[model samples]
Target: MSKYFKKADLILFIIILALSVLGFILLRKPASDNAQIEISIGGEVTEVHNLDTDAEYIIETEHGYNTIQVKSGQVRVISADCPNKDCLNFGAISKEGQIILCLPHKLAVRIIGGEEGLDAVSY
Candidate 1:
């Protein structure tokens, strides 16, 4: 290759390497533990602990009933007594969007941020 072309290629390669290193450094973030999910029942929210690795939950509502099971680091509703049972069919949700709702009891199970010394309520 010509001398000019060789120099240009080297410069391009160095620029690319520098950019990659910078991107890696800038994009890096400290790893955080799994968030502690809060369970809300009857307008009262509380943290659930000692979750059974293979434990299942039963939610009863005036409208219907729903069963939830936890496995593989995720929670899901397995069955329901409601006519539609649509919520039970929602499958398992591990991310923020996943929710289990029992219309009859007005109960909801969802994943929320971990207890980071945050206040329970604000006036």
Candidate 2:
């Protein structure tokens, strides 16, 4: 019984170490110069934008309103009518896989990278 407990302890330690390494890896976001933006409304994709161009966009819905701006290779929510204004406070995001959400209006904005994983159809 004691031998079994020792093996279990060793296995648990290895699992913890692996998880710590993975967490550290995940913390370091990959740098991306140019990326595509995918914005969704009410759980459906509504718009796609690129970070290479400078532009300003306004999103208005019955639930709320938000203003998004892209400039100099980054995107951010400048202003919004959401109660908490969480999106505006989120500042700018330029890295892939970063996301900005306006929960009150059910809006989601995400950065799409060039190196994507296999699609469902491919698998």
Number of the top lDDT candidate:
2
TM-score of each: 0.52, 0.69
lDDT of 2 by residue, 13-69 (tens): 899999988975774355455467778998898888877779988988889788899
lDDT of 2: 0.80
Looking at model 1, residue 24 earns an lDDT score of 59
Best by TM-score: 2
Q: Tens digits of per-residue lDDT for model 1 on 55-104? A: 67665555556676777657777887766666676676665434666665
